[model samples]
Every structure is written in C-alpha cells, then in structure tokens.
Target: MSPSARRRQEAGGKTRPGSPRHFLRLDDLGSGEVETLLERAVALKAYRRTGVDHANLIRRVLGMIFEKPSTRTRVSFEAGIYQLGGHGMFLSPDDLQLGRGEPIGDTAEVVSRMVDGVMIRTFGHHRVEAFAAASYVPVINGLTDSYHPCQVLTDLFTWYEQRGSISGRTVAWIGDGNNMAHSWIKAAVLLGFELRLACPEGFEPDPAILEGGASHATVMRDPRAAAQGADIVTTDVWASMGQEAESDDRERAFGAYQVDSDLMAAAKPDALFMHCLPAHRGEEVTAEVLDGPQSVVWEEAENRMHAQKALMEMLLA
Candidate 1:
C-alpha cells in the first residue's frame, strides 16, 4: 500500500476495501486518493459539457439529509446524482422521523438499508459522525459546523482545473475562520498545498485545526501577510448562516479581512479570487473583486457539480 493509503487504514475508522469511502473530512483522504477524485471530476465535467452520457453510477440511491437549509448544496447534489443516472432522496429535518424524536442510530440503520450512500448537511459535526457510525453504507459529510469537506474538495478541483497542480501553490483565505477555513486546512495537510489564513484575532481558525497536522499551512493576523505571493485568494462570509445574531459584531471584527483590490494586489499578479457564495457585497469580498477578471467564483460553483459527481461514482460504483 502507498504511504497515504496505509496512513488512512491505520487511522482507525471504517473504510471501503481498496476504495476510500465515507468522505467525512479531507484529512481522511490521502494525496493519491484526492488526485484520483480530481482526475475523475475533470473527465466527468468534460463529458457533461460535451453532452456525453456517462452513467457509471446507474441505479444507485443517495439519501440526502439536510438539517440546514442550503441553495448550492441541494441543487448541486441533486443535479449531479440525476446526471450520473442515479437518484437522490432529499430528507428535510421535518420529513424524517428523527425530527419527531426517533433515535439517530435507528434513523441511520433504516436509511442504510434503503440507500447506497448518505450525504448529510447539518449543524453538529457529531451528527454526521453518529450517522457514519451506524451506517452500513457510505456516509458523506456534505457540511457541518466544523467542516464542509465536499465544498473544499470542489474548491481544490477548481484550482487544479485552472492551475494544473496543487503542490507548492499558495492559497490565501481572508474572512471568518469557520467551517470552510477548517476544511481548507485539512485539504492543505492532505494535498500538500500551502494555505495561509487571515482572520480577526478572536475569529481566527480553530486553534486545534492549525496546531493539528495542518501546521504546514500558516495562520496570520494580517490579511496582507496571508495573501502575499499567493496563487489564489479565497474568502467566505464574515458571519455564516447560523451566526446571524452576530452580524454587526462580525462586521466589526472582520473589517480588515475583505478581499478587495488592495488585498489582491498582495497576491501574485495573476492570482485567482474565489468565494464560496452567496457573498455579501462590500463585506467579506467586494463586488468589483467578485466580478473582476481574476475571479473564478462562477467556475468554482460550477465545478461543485462535477466534483461531487466523481465522489458519488467512486463511493457508489
């Protein structure tokens, strides 16, 4: 086995034999597996664009459970599954018996029997963990309070599509140190990409994340420092969906973290700007930067479908 694969096996969790399954976090995947997923995503995207039907994942069933409401997450997964000749069953919190007090274990076990895989977008990271624990089928963490592994995977694929490589490339993150920041750190560790994060002092990325295996990716107080010489500059909202109560406070705290022209100038001359939308204009990112020539936000959004299609194929095929 490759060193990365061996590391995954020794990590002490359920994994598919000869196939990496249950993508709960980027940290669980090795560089080789990430590359494989990315290569497959590229081919799938090309096929989709050319109107070639490549339904390698025919008849597979994916159960999507969403405790949190989303636009991109819902649309991309549903569309990707349909395009791959698979079916996706959407289960909102109210639609599931768990919402009416059924045990998570029972819900997981029941769903496992019916679905080829499960994708969950929810609040607590532990909910996804619990689902994975009881599931006989593959469980994918669509999003959680701590990480958004699927989105990060798509982000990396977008970068790879544009730059052709990830190793040694610098990616600067400017904004709230939330789930995206956490997943990006994990990606840096797993893919050997150099990541730099800039956030307000109190809002800096989870200390445990930076101090963990992702120490190679630096965290800084200065936004300029993070963006300096970076190949890609990325940012998310100052206040995420659940934190709407702290909107004013977040705006104050994240005042200096916007990815405007000033920040972009600190990066490489031709650096790409990325935002995991829906972006707040004049907040985490400026409208000018988001719509500018250097921005790849639209492509990044489009790649989410392709990247997730590859993930489904790998886990379900």
Candidate 2:
C-alpha cells in the first residue's frame, strides 16, 4: 500500500477503503463528527491551558497553497501545524508552477508525494476539489469564494467553549451573503441550529446552500428580526477581498444592516458576537459591539489554530 493508504488503515479506515477523507466543506463531516471535532478542540485547548505537550503530527508535513491572501487563515494553519509538531510549507501562486499553466492534477500528484496533507485557499472551490481528487494524501479547503468552512469550524468550537451545546441555539448572521454565510448554512444543517441571516435585497446567500439548510435557516432584510433572542450574533465584511469595485454601493446598501449594539441587544442578554476578521469597525459592525464584553472575536480567532490542530490530526495523524 501507498504510505497515505497505510496511514489511513492505521487510523482505522474511518473512510471507505482506498479513499482519503477531505475536509472540503463543513457538511463533509457528519453531525457526530462535528461534535467530536468541537469536543476535541475543547480538549486540546484545555490541555494547552494547563501547559501540556502535544506533538501528534511529529515528522508530518502539510502543504498550504494560497491563491488569495489572508491574515488569519495563513497564520492559524501555520501555527497549528507547528504547535502539533508538524511542518507547514506555505506556497503562493508565484512560487508554484501551477500559476504558469501546470495542470492542477500534476501539481497535486507531486505535492502529495512529499507532504502528508495539503490545504488550499483559493478563489475557486473546485481547485481544492481537483487537488483532493488527484492527491494520495488528505486535503483541506482553507477557503474559497463558495465557502470558508475552517473559519466556521473554529467559530463553532469557540461557541462550544463559551456556551456548551449549540444544537438548539439560535445564530444570527448579519451582513453580506458571502462564503462565510454559506459555511454557516452548512453548519446549521449539520449541527442542528437556527440560522437567521439578514442581508440586503440583492445579497441573499447562494440558493443551493440556502436550500440545503432549508429546515433550519431563514433570511430576511431586517437585522432586528434575525437577531431577536439569538444565542450567537455573527457577520463578515460588507465586501470581501475581490469585491472592491462594489465597495461604495455595498456600503450604502449594507449600512442599515450593521450589527450595532442596538441590533445585538435584540439577542439574548448573554449572546456572543462574532466576525471573521479583519473587520471594518464602522462598516459591517459597530465598534461598541465588536469590542464589547459579549464579543468573542479574539478567542474565536485563536480557536482556529486549536480546532485545525484537531482537524489535521484527524486527517494526517
């Protein structure tokens, strides 16, 4: 057997024979798996809090490819691998032949031969899929225009740390209907939560993803309506990286949708606020709410490393 296949067998064949598991999206993990992951994140965090040692990924290597730049995604994954005693290799488009017309499959084959796993953050979700399909090692979707699953996984783990079970909680998502919103939709479906999204008239989340969480998700234009009695209130930037052209228009349209103290007050008294940074204090959310006691943005951000350490262990250890 190939090294990757032999490792999977040693890990107990958690997936079908001859197939490596890929965390390309949140739904890629079953609800039970989600719970386990969150729980693992908690345990890992606790272990670290007491100054324990964790080197599960010793001698392993993760290849991280970035087509889109990010502050948190890059730092968290690299730090996570290092903390777990593994090496993380960062590759940008300029550093790889794939940027100059090399086939994705060819690059995937070459990379997987040397690395234990790969993580990709790119414009198109399909690129990660193509990589996973071709590689012998496991793959992770760091981010895409379609979804940002790892960020949401860290959010869920943070929520679990602060509020315990999220299965019956209400999460309010205010602002743009972007990749983060899509990931939240998948999270609601998998984790059994109520997800209410507030977006402008033309900014609804992808219909297919909205449909996937039909039973537990709702969308409307009223931020107050969505935040009412919510257990967690979250949002992303009004315009993501590539949408700079629409910045002015989006700012106008999303002005009223901001998650300010007034809107946050509509949620439960102990509600936690979340934003996938780097946040524009006065744009998608107000300074008061983001910096308030109820905000867990920093902890939420830090959990990315811990949560992903568990994720990498699941796939590569």
Candidate 3:
C-alpha cells in the first residue's frame, strides 16, 4: 500500500470494507487511484464525444450543497451526473435546514441517507470534514477555503489528457497561495511531480502543507523563476470568492505576479497555460495570454465534468 493509504488506515480513515470513500483531499486517494481516475476520465470524455451511452452511475443521486457561489462546479456536476444516468439536486444554504442553524453533520447525515453522494462548496474546510465524518455516503470537496480538491484533480486530469504522464514534469503556480495552490501541493507530493509556486510573501500557501511536499515543491517570489522551463504554467484569481472586500489590496499586492506574456515566455515554448476560471482578464492574466494559443482554460473547465464523473463512480462503488 502507498504511504497515504497506510496513513489513512492508521487514522481509522476507513472503518469497514463497505464504507464510503470520501474525497476531502487529494491525498485521500492513493496515487494508483488517481491514475485510474484520470484514465477513466479520458475514456468518459471520448464516450461523450462519440455519443456513446455510458450509464455507470444509473440510479445514483448526488446532493450538491453550496455555501458559496459557483458556476463551473455547479453546472459541471449537475450535467455530469445527469449524463451518467443519475440526478443531481442543488441545495443552497437557504434551500435546506442548514440555513436555519442546523449543524453541518446533521444536515450531512440526513442528506446522505437520501443521496448516493454529496458534494460541498463551502468556506471552511472543516465544515466538509465534519459533514464527511457523519455521512453514510461519499462526500466530495467541491471547493473550500483551505483546499479545492476537485478543481486540482480536474487540473491534473487535464494535464494527463494532454501529455501522457506528469510524473517528472514541472508545474508552475503563479498566484495567491489559496485553496487551489494547497491542492496542487498535495498532488505534487502524491504524483511525483515538481511544483514551483510564486506568491507575494504573505500570500504563500500554508506552511504545513508546503512542508509536506518539501521534496517536490518549492516557493519563490519571482513568477518568472517559477515559470522558467515549466511544462505547465497555471494560476488563479488574486482575490477568490469571499475575499471581495480585499480586492483592492490584493490587486496592489498581486500586480507584479500576473501571468502575462513575459511570464509565459519564461516557460517552455510548448508549455500550456491554465486558469481555474471566472478569470479576471486584466488582473491575474492578460487578454493576450488568456486568449492565446497556449491557453487551455476552456478544455480545463470541461474536464471537471469528466473527472468528477470518474470520481463519483469510484466513490459510489
């Protein structure tokens, strides 16, 4: 077994043979499981394109609870589950008892009893952990303050779809060290890839998370240094959801960290540019680079559906 699996077992992560497999973090999955998910995602993408009827998730139901706003996360999972012969219900905070001060674990228990799986996009990572702890079905972290596991997993699947393997390739992260960056760090450690992050000093990813991947991850202030020779150059918005009040301040702090042409030029000529979108064209990236030939943001966005379909299938199994 992989070290991550061993750690999970030691922590009583899985209590029984038939227990649900929750994806609260990337490390919750073994490397081999990630590889399998990506492979299945590729097949599922092709199946969609070819108009093949793949209903592996027939009769399944997914409950998507959103404590925050979302576009990609919402549409992708709703459509993906429908395409897989299942139903997806969107539950806003006001739509459920959760809005009325019900505990997250109580809501999770009630909802999981009715659905095959639950996907949460929320503010606190601890909320998802609490929900998963009480859920009888699988729980997927759609996005959280500390980690955006689904998005990063989709990003890795996007990389795998383009290039065969990302094991030895370098990935440059040039923006805020928020949830996205933390997930990338976990991925680098588990998948044997090199991850270089460029963040304004105070915006660096969590120290404990960074330290865990010390063997394969490095932090620096220069976007150029991080992008230099990287196979994939990726970034996210300076101010993410719930950080709107800090937008002005973040804009000033992240002004020099934008992934513009000069930064892209520092990476290999064939390197791809990716952004987990709802992009600020003039902020974290420029119009030139975002709409350029190297940017695969659209495909990256589409892969969220394919990737999560594979994940849901695995967890529900």
Candidate 4:
C-alpha cells in the first residue's frame, strides 16, 4: 500500500472518511473557495499558454476510474495531470473487481491506497458517494447520473474568462433537464446566478434538486422565453448517456427546444453560447448557432483541463 493510503486509513484529517476534502459535488466547496479556484484556473491557463513548465504535482499519481466512455474527460484529465507533472492511471470497471460486483467502498479503499487522488466518472451518484465515503484520498466527481460537476465547473470558468463573475448573469438552459442541468442548478444556488431552465414537462429537473435552488432558478416551458434577455444560452443533448433507449421519444419531446439562430437572437447581443458537448447538431442545437460568433465552446472545452488542474491542486496541495 502507498504511504499516503496508510496515513489516511490510520488517521482521517478530522476523524471522518472525507476529512481532507472531496470534489464529489460543486457544493463541496464554498463560494470563496470557488472564486479562488476559478482565479487559479485562469492563471494556470495563461501560465501554460506561454509553454512554461511547472511541476507542482511532481511524482504524484491520480487514479481515474471510468464506468462510462468519454472523449473529453479522459483526454483533458490525462493531459492536465501530465502537464502538472503527475501520472494519471486510467481504470475501468473491467480492470477491477467493481465490475465483478465488489462493493464500491472496498474498491475505493484498495485504490486510494495506491494513488494520490481518485476521479470517478460513473453511472450512479450513489456509487461515487459510496466510493468517496471510503476513499483515503480526494475523490472528484468526473460525472455521474445526477451531476456533471466537473464539466459545469469548466463552463463557469470559461464564462468568467469572457464575461465577469456569473453571480447575477442570466443563463438559459435549453433541452433535457439531465445531469448537466442538475449540476447547473447547484451552481446557481452557490453562485447566486439566475438559471432559467427551459425543459419539457416530463423532462423537468428533479424537483428536489430545483427546490434547493428555487431562489436562484426558474423552470419555464418555452425555450425562447428562457433565452430572452439572457446573457448566456446553453444546452445539452436531449438524451444523455444510458438514455439512448429514449432517443426517439426525447428527440420528439425536445425538438422544439433547440438553440437555433432564432433562439440565440432572443438572448443578449453578446450572449455566450455553450454546450457540454458531444452536441448533436440540428438536435439540441443548430449547426449555425454552434459554429457562430458567440460560441466559446472550444475554449470552454479546453478550460476543462485547466480548471481540473486547479481543482486537483486545491485538493492535493
């Protein structure tokens, strides 16, 4: 077992399983910490932009566990850690006993013993929570059925880079109220932003999730209305991972919610366009709008690495 793992097991920071801190959700960090993190992320991006090398995490190791396939999360994290002078080991359920029905906590205990931190992209939120409860190191929620915290964090960081603080800005969310929507709700509550979510009736965000953020968010049926005067127009696919079976129905239910030129026109003149991506053109968003002037998606996507590097530094430092 790694020395860090043995230390964690023998003594949690304050006698709790999550004593050192975990990024399982956005709420895990307070507003001040969030602000500090965003500033650090921007600095890291600029610092690396000049091709300078910094080895803050020299010789550290991070264990990345993915139960779902990813193009952005995997690549961004792998590249980010290497750039920070750490090694990231990618693991799949099939690579461990978790696929063979081993309890999540048991696997977490075993892995946290060998790595400096653990990042999990899995199907269930409970799975991530359970793993964190047993993990000896910091655990990051790469993605989960109920929340995509890391992606939203990167989005917020991108918005901060172009605009200013997102505290009072109006953000319109169009399409299925899935994990991305849920994570946005958490951000709204934490950062005091007005999140106008336009999702179809049956596809509305979980009431329990919205309830906590009710003061900062609104649920609307008309996508255009939500986008009107908004400072940011964002969306996600009608069907997320594992919901492919509902694609046909979701396509019908969400057809009217697409962020096209018309909808984009409803927002502020300089409103930013964002998508958590793997976006389906002509579906949740139009090809024109996605490729248009206001779209900072490529920058937003690239920020994932910078933002996550800052997050890793926050926890691992």
Candidate 5:
C-alpha cells in the first residue's frame, strides 16, 4: 500500500477480516475501490428509477449523530437508508446525552451495539476518530472540520456519471481550503487527476494533505489561471458553517474568487460547473452560472443519496 493509504487505514482503524471498516477519509478506500463504488452508485441510481427492489440493507439500522445542521446530508442518508430496507435514527445534541457531557467513546460503544453502522457530522475530526476506535460497527465521517469525505465521494460519482472517467482530467477548485478542498486533494492523489486550487493568499488547503498530493495538486492565487484548461470547475461558500463570525472578513478576502461567467469562460467550453449547494447567488458563484446550462449542482445533490447508499453497503458488506 502507498504511504497515504497506509496512514488513512491506520487513522480509519484496523479491523479483522470479518469486522467492519471505517471511512474517516477518502484515502481510506483505494483507487479501485473508489471506482467500483462509483459504478455501484450508478447502478443504484438506475435501480431507483426503475423501482427495483434492491433492498440489500434489510433489517439494518444506521445511527446518524449530528452536531451540525444539514439539508442534504440528513435527508439523503435518512431517506437512502429507508429505501434500502434499513432504519435511520436521527440523534441531535438535544436528543443525545452528549450535550450534557457524555463521553464520545461511551456514546459510540452504546450506540454501535444497537445500530449496524454510525455516521457522525461534528466539528472536529478527532471526535469521529474517537467514536470509530470505540465502536464495533462501521463508522462514517458524515462531515468533519478536517474532511467531508462523503460529499467528495458523491461529487466523484456525479463526475463519473457524466464523463465516465476523471483520471487525467483537470479539476479547478476556487474558494476556501476547507474540508471539501481537503477531500478533493485526497481524491486527486488516489485517482490520478490534476487538481488546481485557487484561493486567496491565506486560505489554502491543509498543508500536509496538499503536500501528500503535491504531484497532482497545485495551489495558486489567480482563479482564472487555475480554471484555465480545466474540465471541472467547482467552488464552495466563502464562509462555511461555524465561520459566520468571520463573514465580513471572508467576504473581503474572497471577493475576487467568485466563479462568475467571466471566470467560467476561462475553463474549457464544455467544462461543468459544480457547487455543494445552499449557494449564494451573488457571492461565491453567480446566479446565471449556477442556474445555467453547464451547472450540474442539482444532479450532484441527488447523487449524494445514490453514492452514500453504495458506501453504506460497502461498509456493511
């Protein structure tokens, strides 16, 4: 295994042949595995449309713990699990005793016993790691400050559904070096793609992750330069969740990085525009571009359900 894969497997936790696997980061799965999952996602999508009875996860239960509010993640996982003949139990801070200072390991141990798998959307990456360490069942990182693996996994499936292959393609990311960027960096390293990130001077992606994928990823200041000759151009909000306090400062810093018509012009003519939505029309991306022909944000959002179903099945298998 590669050094990055080895590190991810270690971080994801070791399991015996018949035990569960954890998806703490994108590198937790190898390149071939990622591709296979994407293919499965496509099959799942088709099966959903055909009204096929592919309830592979019958009688299973998924415990979803959310410290952060969500639109897509919550709905997708809950509905997806139900469609797969499983139950999704939503646990919020108000619902769980963890708000009253319950230990995460204790919560993990207790929860994993009842649920077939657990997914957590929290502030810190270490919280998910701690839970995975204590749990007997599979653990998935729904969203973390360090990496939003599922979002990138869904994004990859969206790209794959459209283009059939992403290897050797150019993916331009224009925004903060947040969790999405980190996951994209990991994806680039694993999938042999070129990733160009154009962020303001101080908003680059995590250095260690960037360095690990240095051969396939590049950081730059000019958005157009990064988008130049790109096949996929994507960006996120200027300020992510919990960073609302720095809204004004972030607005000032990222003003020039918006993915507008002019910016989209820099990429190839047939290039696709993508955003993990709840998008701001006049901010990070313009209304015309987001609602325009090249934009696939809506399809990308729906793919979240299909992609995650494939992931959950893999973990349970």
Candidate 6:
C-alpha cells in the first residue's frame, strides 16, 4: 500500500476503521497527497480492467446530496459506489431538510451521524465548507460555484492514462472560465503542468484563483496564444447554468475564443481535445473538433467513475 493508504488506515478517532474522508478543494491537499490519490485511482482502474474484485469498501454508504441537477456527477458517483461494493444515496434538494430552511451545519451534523461519507454538489463553495465544518465524517465537494475538483481530477487521470504524465505538458483552456477552468488552474499548479487560459475580458476565472495559479500558469487574452504548443486544448460552455441572461453577450464576446479546427491545429499535432461536457457545440467548440479523433471527452467522462471510486475508498478505507 502507498504511504497515504497506510496513513489513512492508521489515522484514529473521526477517521474510524475504513472511513477516511475529504472535502472539495484541491488546495485542501498538498502536492504529495494529490499524487497518492491519483496513484490509487490508476491502480483501481487497472484492477477493474483485469476483472479483479478489489471491493475494499463493501457495505459502506456514501450520501450524495445534490442541490443542482446533474447527469454525469450523479451517475458516476452512484455507479462508482456500487462498483466498490458500497451503496449510494442520491438526495435531491427537495428531499432534505436543507431545502426547508434547516441550517447547513445542522444538516451536516445529522448526515455525518448517518452516513460513512457525504458528497455534496451545490451552488456555493461556502456551503461545502459549512458542511465540512459541522460534520464529523468526511465530505467530498461534488461541485461548487468556485471549483469542481473531482472533474479536474478525472480529467488529469485520463491524461495520465493516455500520455503517462503531465509534468511539463501545456494545457490550454478556452471558454467562459467557470468552475471547471478554476479547477484546471488548481490542477496545473499542483501538478506543475504549464497552463494557459483564454476567456473574454470580463468573464475570467476568480482573480484569487488566477493569481494563485499564476506562479505556475500563463493567463492570456488570445485563445490561439494559449493554444500555441499546447499538448491539450480544452473548453466549456460560454454561459453556465445560472448565467442564462448573459448568454447573448457572452457569445458575442467569446466569438474569438472558440476551440475549432484552426485553434486545435495550432496546438501540437497529437494534442488532445477536451471539454467538460454538456457542450455548446457551435458556441464554445465546433462539432468537428469535439467529435474528432483526438477528442478524449468520453474517456475523460469514464475516468470520473474510476477517480471518484478511488476517492471514496481513500476517504472511507
């Protein structure tokens, strides 16, 4: 077992036997700790491919609380739990007292007593922090307005599987610079990969996150500049779920940032194309590029299950 695995097994009190847990932010972990999780994920994926029964987390329960609607996040985590010999509880907003004016702290305190771990996909990063603060059990950030760490973890895992490593590679992100972009920035910082982000003037990622990642990344105005010599070119929708009113303006402003064939061609010949899905085909990415041979969107999606399974096992070992 790895050092992290050993440490998890030995940690006392709140961790309990087979119940290690985590929160939603990448900054919550040191670089070495992140590597430990990734290594475990790779091992788990390999074991599954070979049909090995490594269900170390059997009979555990992961309470999945979602304040927002989802497709991949819900299915991936639920299926991941079962694959690891555990079961998952999918709780929608209306299903919990949280939707009826109960405090997040109260909800957290109650859930911790009931579940081995909790994964919350919600609107604010602060809500996740509140849940973590109140709960004795582990809490995983499924997604938040500020970051989507799991998605980026899976994306990096997929990249690792395909290219072996990301230490010196350049990753170019082209789009609205939302939560996914923020998480990617965090990944670049922790993994020491060169990152370039291109977004419209006003629609950039959080300044704090950008500044924090600046020591390791290069933020730019031009998509082509970011894509130049990149090993991977990525994008997401121009307007996110709650930003519907800005859709028209965003499309106009982001016209120069589309990840079409021309932009992909500027990257390395073998550069992979990526998008956190629910893609806006013609708005942020052209159908040709998203459906192209180099696109790893589907593989990236699949890795979510593997990476999340590794996460649950690590937190609930």
Per-candidate TM-scores read 0.93, 0.94, 0.94, 0.95, 0.94, 0.92
Q: Among all windows of ten consecutive residues in candidate 1, which has the lowest summed lDDT? A: 11-20
Question: lDDT for every model?
Answer: 0.86, 0.90, 0.91, 0.90, 0.92, 0.85
Candidate with the greatest lDDT versus the true structure: 5
lDDT of candidate 3 over 1-317, digit per residue (tens):
76533433454323344457799999999999999999999999999999999888888999999999899999999999999999999999999998999998778757877788899999999999999877777999999999998989999999898988999999999989999999999999999999999999899999999999899999999999999999999999998988999999999999999999999999999999999999999999999999999999999999999999999889875
Model 1 spans > 4 angstroms off: 1-20
Model 3 is weakest, by summed lDDT over 10 consecutive residues, at: 7-16
Error of 3 at 157 (Å): 1.2
In model 3, residue pairs whose N, Cα or C atoms come closer than 3 Å (at least 3 residues apart or on different chains), thus clashing, are: none
**Which whole-number lDDT from 0 to 100 does residue 60 have in model 3?**
90
Model 1: per-residue Cα lDDT over 63-163, one tens digit each: 99999988898899999999999999999989999899887877986787677899999898999998887676788999999999989999899988878
Best by TM-score: 4
Q: Candidate 2, clashing residue pairs?
A: none
Give me the runs in candidate 2 sitting further than 4 Å from their true place: 1-17
lDDT of 6 by residue, 127-239 (tens): 99888866767899999999999988888888878887788899998877789889988888888988888887887889888999887766689899889999999988888
Candidate 3 residue runs with Cα over 4 Å from true position? 1-18
Instruction: Point out where model 6 deviates above 4 Å.
Output: 1-21
Model 4's alpha-carbon lDDT is 0.90
For every candidate in turn, the CA RMSD to the true structure comes to 5.5, 3.8, 5.1, 3.2, 5.0, 5.3
- What TM-score does candidate 6 get on C-alpha atoms? 0.92
Residue runs of model 5 more than 4 Å from their true location after superposition: 1-19
CA error at residue 52 for candidate 1, angstroms: 1.2
